[model samples]
Target: MALNRQLWIAIASVMVIAFVSSLAISFQSARAYFEEQLHLKNIDNANTLALTLSQVEKDPVLIELMIAAQFDTGHYQRLELLDPSGEPIASRTRATDAVGDVPGWFAELAELRVDPGIAQVPDGWQQYGTLYVESLSGFALEALWDTTVELFLWFFGIAAVLGLLGSMVLKSLTRPLDDVVDQAESIGNQRFIATPEPRTLEFRRVVRSMNILSARVRDMLGEERSRLEEMRQRLQRDALTGVGNRGRFDDVLGALLADDDPNRQHGLFLVRLVDLAEINRQLGHQKTDALIKELATRLGTVAGEHRDSFSDDHLARLNGSDFALILTDLLDAKPLAERLTEAMQELAARHAEATSLQLALSAGRFGPGDERSSILIRLDDALARAEHRETTCLEWATQGEDVDRLHGSDEWRAILHDAIEQQRIHAAHFATRRIDGRLIHREAMLRLEDARQTLTAGQFLPWARRLGLLPQLDLAVAESELERLARTPDPDGEPIALNLSIDTLLDESTRGRLLGLLASHTARAAMVSIELAERAAIDHPAAFREFCAVAVPLGYRVGIEKAGLAVTEIDVLHELGLSYLKLDRSLTTDLAASESNRSYLRGITGMAHAIGLTVIADGVRSAEELTQLGELGVDGASGPGVPE
Candidate 1:
């Protein structure tokens, strides 16, 4: 059925046909030549014997003796003598009709027939009697059979050698076709990668055409990502400093506070340049802007050093003189605030335009159940007190609860370890649906419960990550999801999408274990989807690629959550056989107001759908946003706004 095999069969058939035809022609020619030679020998020998008899005396008894002597001396089947009147005769005949050493089948096929040689003899004065002489043909037939067999063997050997040579040549010629087939299959899988062109003229043309198509798609993705990034910067970024604006900061903080987990808390630093007006008056606005940009960059770098995952939105310029730094993890704020002060002083010393810079830093913690207005007022009050000190300084805002009461690192680690080992880890399912209200899947978020309280992933994931137990937690979540699927085996049941941490995917041993579990429950695994954060997937592409390569084949739909955050990695998306891409909640917030973001999202959905990936929006808070998402060709959306 394969093309290569078909070609081999055709070549073999041609060789067989040629061998048969050549053998038949050669056998026929050998048989004719042997028959002619035998005929001539029989004629010559018969005439010679009859002439000898004519030279001798004619006698019945003597003639009989002559015939018997001739038959005994020569290779003959029969010899005869007869009178001219055909009344009396003397004859010599071979008693046994056996073909010596030749096979019966070959003898039947040869079937040699040569006319007997005949001659006349006369008496002394008159014709005493007419004599008849004939010669045998068994030896002649045996010679012809040997020649035919030798010719057949020669033809067979030549055909076998030609067939071997033809097979090798056919393989070489069709090697390029194999590559073409592989390339087509990759395209079918939606991984648009180009392959090298082959030397065969026809195959080279086809491959080059496919490569062009792949390149076009890649270029389109790159162009769309560039456009989306440009629009996002315009909407969410500060023009002068390139960090997030006040609006972007509010969005991130609001989302963080809106989480259902009361234990979710992070440190926030509000830094104000106390002398921005004075600096702009004394130095040019350009110098002031440069100074602000420099300070923002240094602040972002410090935040990056403290946190493993860094983003531009983490450091934002709230206004002309105020900048905010959000650290997602709870740490000793004084030490980090000291580092910021040192960085600011270093910047002041290096700036040639400014004589000196004064700043007031307000540090505090913010979480759920806290009012944004009240927290800002407290931090502003703290900033006023720091400004009253008359020197560059930092002050901590008053908190309703003591930070020291929180669990220590070892305690949290033990708690997480016990929860996983004791099988206390579970998941809460959130349904995502299509525009037509059909259920797509139920997204699973990890939850940990104890005797008195329940903890969401937003509450405990940071600690789990800090304690390096995310791999265990992720495995626990996958196991829970698998068991849930096994229990609910209805064909119409919505699949559960399990979120896998980048930590587990990056570790070889953990990744192997996860894949092994999926392999064991292959049928049930089909009812579960695996997903990773967009930023993590972008940061570590090799691990994401390897994860997809393994998980996708195990009947798991692999995808990226919080997608559209990193637009620059769009080119890598087509290379990864992803099942879906979930747009971040930030992209959909107030979608009706921002035409730029709508266009950006439209481009994302277009490109994603072009490659056969389903696009979903996360945290849609209003019917208006959901309707707009549907109008933009988004496949599905999930949030408080989407009705169950």
Candidate 2:
């Protein structure tokens, strides 16, 4: 039963018990009082009669007549005259017929007591005869009936009233608890904090304790989450830009696109800087890094708008002059691209003075049916098609028969996952950036060639990440690149910069594997510096540093690609003892035009060189910018600008 019902029941039971007790006591008292009154009346009448009989002495007939008259007028039994020896001398019957309205059973049940009465004979002790009488008890029985009925009515009426009042009292006490429970459930991933101002002192105290406990739990959970998130962010983010890394993009984006909900669409874009080499030469690495940070903050604001529509759309630095975005679960591509271009236009307007702030955004859209390789090829194509010094541009990819298609939604992901584990991944083409005749770093793009045309890294990246298969992909692709390097030795003794993910590095096992892969060639160790997106390193600064502590000593150096304009705190990257920094594409596309861009590139390069780090420029498509990079004293330059 409900608490209120149970309380009311208990109260009613007690009241019933009390009423029963009261009724028993009441019944007895009423009987005694009525009987005493009747007995006193009988005694008074008997005394009066005795006096009358004494005055009528010497006349037996008058005495008998007076006694009979009194007996007939009053409620009494018989009046009799007996001798001193207890024998009856004279008697008046008074009962004409000896019939009674009361049944024998009822009279026996009642069994009321009557008081004895006596009349003096021969006028005060003559001793001729003694008078006898009985008292009436009819009034006593009537009184008892009336009192019992009143008691019954009162007992029922009072119990009902008390029962209702008691239930209300209990309800008031428990209502606050019900409210507390509701508030607790509403909390989600968030924590609860409720301090009620109850009217009752006891409840108010309870609420206070509850509030304190809730706050404590919230704090504890938040602290734990912060610790775990720091580690995860380190693994999945870029160190310089403070955004997600390339691993998160490939793995996370692929999974998002695979979900073929008509409500959600997918878009990925790349933004490159035009003047990072100039910035590195003029402003130094510190200020160039600052510009990347400023640009990241601006773009992040636009991406944050779709936060609710997407679960985890990560934006990250892919390399210096190249920042990437994996927009998961979008409604459509056209509007998203349009909105992005608008956002970039606004960003450019804000940093109009920053020459290195010139951003060229190349966006690509793909659906569930679209092939991963084709999408990436299309993005590469879009970049190739991007106008010189363009601020914003967009393109949508279509599905073709040559691209891998699965039977069901999950079947395709399964195939890709199997391919990565078996080391089926192969490299198709490599673009290397050199300082003069020395080959320093090479950007290795993967190709899945299986009984068909070559597949680009983009095709598998999205799926691999989505299916939680990037670790496998990272291993396969890195190992393949290393194997190819072992076969094709570079004539130039320059350091080789190969693409590496902070995700794989943070994983001790993967880091160990990478170390083992590079262990054979001690001469190539300094030549092969692993490249990563800065967002990953920054997010996991501590862990990345820890991994570096182990790996850097093993003769493996780290390089950061997709380095943005600047970030909240870029000191973490410098402190980690990184070897090289690449400017993100967003800041470099129009380096020659924007003065702000010149300032930023100068700032980042100067900072990097101050820390004994080399700055490599990627996506340098024009010869004019190439000559400008040489003037800026950039350590190296990549993209189509290197006399392709």
Candidate 3:
């Protein structure tokens, strides 16, 4: 065991010994403290009573009966009357059930002793009798019992607190060992990572060793990674262009084509320089390489714009003035090619004027039904056909399909409007999450249905915005949803959350109507939460703040959605006094071994908690992500992991 545990055991044993010893001393002292007072009180009362009894002319039997009656009612230990001869005539002992019912073993253990009161009697200035009295020990027994129980209870409670503190110390000391192991494993597995050291001396030594080991292991892995990266560059990288070579591009294209879905076609754009040999003849090899490098730089800039559009797809330079891109999840093929050509032309125009060589891009697409080997043949043929073409960009068939998909945007607006008017709104999909088993968060989903078309937000919202009707369309969706909700399965006693857009906020009439309708359902509105995206939040901060100020007092709770994006303005969210905050999806999706995202989430989540705002992480799609969020102490979460 570590020193903390050893210290705990030693201190506990000493405390146990000290507690027992102190208890013994306290018991005896308590008896002495109360007994002294009890005995003194008895003496005073007996003396006063005897003086009073001396002037009385009652009969002897009556006097004895009166003294006995007082003892019966009072807390007297004993009462005795002696004749003028100094012989005991009448006697009575205290008979309270308090002392009588207690076990003798307990009374003896405390060394309880209650002194009896004694008094003198006088008849016409001569001694008549002596009175002996005993007060009840029950009060003293009760006091002693109370003191004993209280003292022991104090010792036990303090000892329990000490035990808890000792355990915490042990945990803190051993805590760094866990971090050390984690760092070691990360280093050994070729993950370059480090952890903070433990505070304890003994564990710090072990942690220092692990730190050194972790550093050495990381250094070794870094050296190895550098070596492999160089090898990869040498084998499949172009020396002058500094981009992936033809072999690498070939491999990437093969994999992308193989993975294409039947409904989604993948596009390949091959850009071939028309005059590489001509440029080399006029300019030396060095200047030709310089031009190619400039071309490569421009291509990279164009590629950066589409980086976040998809995953596992990349753009690379194949060879002299030749580049390729693998576009997946493409709904259609034609417009993507035209867009690529327009983007490249825009980027190309930025280069110095009077450049002899221009960029030529020829695109050939392969669908799930196309054979991989034949796709390359078609691409090569397209490149060959573009050799003498006048235009810099050309597409090989399927051009009209891209034009049709481009036109689909206008159709989406009509589709959304018809879905709302024709009562085609599908059943709402809402997800629920519990926090501390006390509060539940309901996340609402918008479902669209048509004979042959159903739309995801990603596909339809852009069209709504483009048509300048998103405000009207959003209200329609909201009204349809609420109208359907009002019909059956009301959201009473449940906190239901919905979203509002910037366009809606700009519309005074729609905003008033939306809030008015929601306010009518006061009970549900009290449990209702309205949310807006961070981009929209920042864009219309003034309007949103005003809206929230009015809505919140009307029994509505407001939340800033995609909160992780505005981590810098966490105080802005706090100032608005939000009831809940939903973290950005991208932040949660990037939580695997990413130091930046984890730190960002931690800081923002801490800020949210400090402001008394409920923190809900959205798009927690994995068990590992859920566990990580729980460890970070997120208030609640709703995603695929949460059941509907």
Candidate 4:
């Protein structure tokens, strides 16, 4: 039984027992008083009758008439007169019909007994006869019944009022207890949350202890995240300028090009400092190194300022004099080229030693199916062309050969809107599996079929976000998956995971529609899980929390995808109530090769498991990597390398 119910039962039982005991004691006391009063009235009436008879004539007929009159006038059960020889002279008895409105059971329960009063009537110093009178108990019984009824009514009413008040008070007292239980459940689920202290001393102490635990876990997670971040920087970043190195750039660009989605396109820029050896000798090593660092910082600032232009961007130092910038889904390269040229000029002007410095800037576009070597060769050719034009020039390698698929924002918006309206959106399922080769779930990646070709989310998602059409596209995918789940007759069919953009989750109307759609198909809702990028939770913490608060309780699992990209604030998972984390491909690639990567994975898995979160690694390209991930405590793996 629930503790609250038990407490209520205990309180009710006590009230009932008190009421019964009080009623019994009160009734018994009232009954006894009524009996004693009856006895006293009988004695008084008998004595008065004897005195009246003694004062009157001692005729038998007269005595009999007096007895009848007294019995009729007073409430007497019986009246009698006896001669000196012990024989009855006159007698009067009351009938049983005189009992009033009192119930029989009550009359019996309150039945009163009193001895008949007896007195001698003397005539001239000689004993005459004895007069006997008994008082009727009907009147006393009726009064006792009335008093008992009144007492019962008063006690019943008071008890009802007290019972209601007690329940409310109990609820108030136990509310804090309920909050504590919820906190414990959250901890068990790997989400650490703190609750306010209750007014009750015991509950307050318990809540304080739990808050301490949550805070400690949060601190530990923060430290772990920092360590992972440090490891990632060491493994992927340029040691001198604090940007991505040649290897990291190759890994990222290779992954992009390797994707099957033809829509994966980006604008790439390669900046080379001309006559670097001469400049280095003139400026000395320290000043030249500072100048290189300043250049990297400037590129980082530009990327930050124009972050919205690209969904994903990379800035890297290929060598001492060569730097690269790749921006995904950039429709216009001329404006960014102009911005880069201005930044380069500012760098040269700021550093007086580089007044005679020359820079060659080259720009090109690459997409899926393009070889990494061919793209780099084209950019190199463009850099050589820029050198011939002047000391510094911006040269486009693909000139008129590669035009953007869409001309302007309006065209992009129209195409995306029509794609959604025409039902051109669909899903492609990729299975995620456990270490034992059991199916976990299939992730449904959204695909859009246009007039010319098919586009993956990676190819078109940034444009959709720019056009404010993500909510519509996300809903389309969600609705399709829900329909598919509903069509599957098996209740235990494999679950499917669908991604929702942060913008969709933030839109109030879209969120309502999504929740309503899921609710309308409650049975299938559980067979579908919703996912968002880890950056979503870190950027819009309140919105993510609100969505999870509603979605998780409605039988839909909520998780973070691409989790390890933002390792510094990943500890926010403790407060976001996420069910799982999907490690990004960069972290999982060549998992068995790098000791640093293995250590980072171990730390991530350990922290995630301690908090009760399932960890899944993405882009596991080989069985060896899968095995290594399993050994590192990853719960699941998904990629082309994983078998169906």
Highest-lDDT candidate: 4
Q: Which of the predicted structures, 3 or 4, would earn the higher TM-score when compared with the native?
A: 4
- Relative to the true structure, how large is the alpha-carbon lDDT of every model? 0.76, 0.62, 0.65, 0.81
Clashing pairs in 1: 83-130, 84-130, 123-128
| TM-score (C-alpha) between model 2 and the true structure | 0.50
Please provide, for model 2 over 571-614, each residue's C-alpha lDDT reduced to its tens digit, 9 standing for 90 to 100.
44434546777766544655665454455566566556645678
Models ranked on TM-score: 4, 1, 2, 3
Q: Is candidate 1 or candidate 4 better by lDDT?
A: 4
Among these predictions, the greatest TM-score belongs to 4
lDDT of 2 at 314: 62
What clash count goes with each model? 3, 91, 5, 1
List TM-score per model, in order: 0.81, 0.50, 0.46, 0.85
Q: TM-score for model 4?
A: 0.85
Better of 1 and 2 by TM-score: 1
Candidate 3, residue 180: the lDDT equals 78
Q: Please write out the lDDT profile of model 3 over residues 1-644, one tens digit for every residue.
A: 76666777877787778877987888778888878887887888789778878878747787878787777778776778878677776778745436644456777776557686688878886887887766777777777777766777887788778878887876776788878777665543334455676678887888888778766754553444344345545654677776767655654554344331333455677777677787678777887777777767766655545533322234567766677766544444455566667766664465435355556777765654677677766777777776666446665733442423423755766776787678665434456475443446565555567677665553445455545555666666667656655664755645567777677887888888887777666655665677877755665778887787678767777887766433443224544646878875545654565554565566566655645677787766566667788777687777766556
Query: lDDT of candidate 1?
Result: 0.76
